[model samples]
Target: MSEVKLVLSYKETIQSKLDERTKELIIHAKNASQNAHAPYSSFHVGAALLLSDGEIVAGANQENAAYPSGLCAERVALFKFGFDKRDRYLVKAAVAVPQIKGENLVPPCGACLQVFAEYRAMQSTPIEIVLVNGSGKVLIAPDIYTFLPFAFTNRSFKYFI
Candidate 1:
């Protein structure tokens, strides 16, 4: 095993200052949050993915009666995109979360991060991750790997195929 240096340059800015595409992604994610079925948590979340084909896919968190069966907004959108468009490159991803008072935007959970790592590994280009809060504050990471420094990849394990 070799030591790998992790470099994360997460930029913070207001929504108004973001580029058009990023702004649009945030808007879509926020709108999608309205459809979240989080009766138990009451924490609505939404996610939007920008595909290289110039299409955006959005999904809202869906809670199930069985607590563990529920899915996060990030996974909802990513799974939907991966299901049918695995070949299309995931250029960027935006996650919108309700801002907690006196707190910052919450990053995606570990499971979601792992799924993101899988998708990123499937493509040659890096996937930019944008996180936004209800206050219009935005945090931009250059790539998904910025959030998961020790993300598990195919190289992490060997398969006897």
Candidate 2:
């Protein structure tokens, strides 16, 4: 039997050496964390999306009593971008989560990754992702697939073609 392997790619960079635009996006995400409504988990999370038009949209996690009714910070930002500017492409995304002492970096959920994959498939371009730790360290992935190896993409339905 033959075996197939999936590989994930990412880059870890110092915050000071990051490009100006990346730094800006991370900053927005960090600030957005302050607006998170996570009374249950007390884990505030924020996400920022950079559109092709140079506009940055940010979102904070909003928790609800029903639990599942609430959405993640990444989804909130992505949905806002999709609704407001359906024609534009999402160039990059950054996430920031606050820890008890400081803060931590977390990856997007599976649902969010699926949504991102759809958008990336439509654009035929890569979407950069920035993950920042509580100490402000940054990890950069060139595309969503890096965070979701063996992901389900639109191409998976090619049988219909």
Tell me each candidate's TM-score.
Answer: 0.91, 0.92
Error of 2 at 18 (Å): 0.4
Q: Could you give candidate 1's per-residue lDDT for residues 64-156 as a string of tens digits? A: 999899999999999999897887899999999854433388789999999999888878578999998888888899899889977887756
In the range 1-161, model 2's lDDT, one tens digit per residue, is 99988777887776799989998998999899999989998888889999999999999999999979999999899889888988789999999874623344578989999988988888989999998866777889999989886667788788677
CA RMSD per model (angstroms): 2.1, 1.9
Model 2: what TM-score?
A: 0.92
Clashing pairs in model 2?
99-103, 103-134
The segments of candidate 2 whose C-alpha lies over 4 angstroms from its true place after superposition are 100-104
Error of 2 at 73 (Å): 0.2
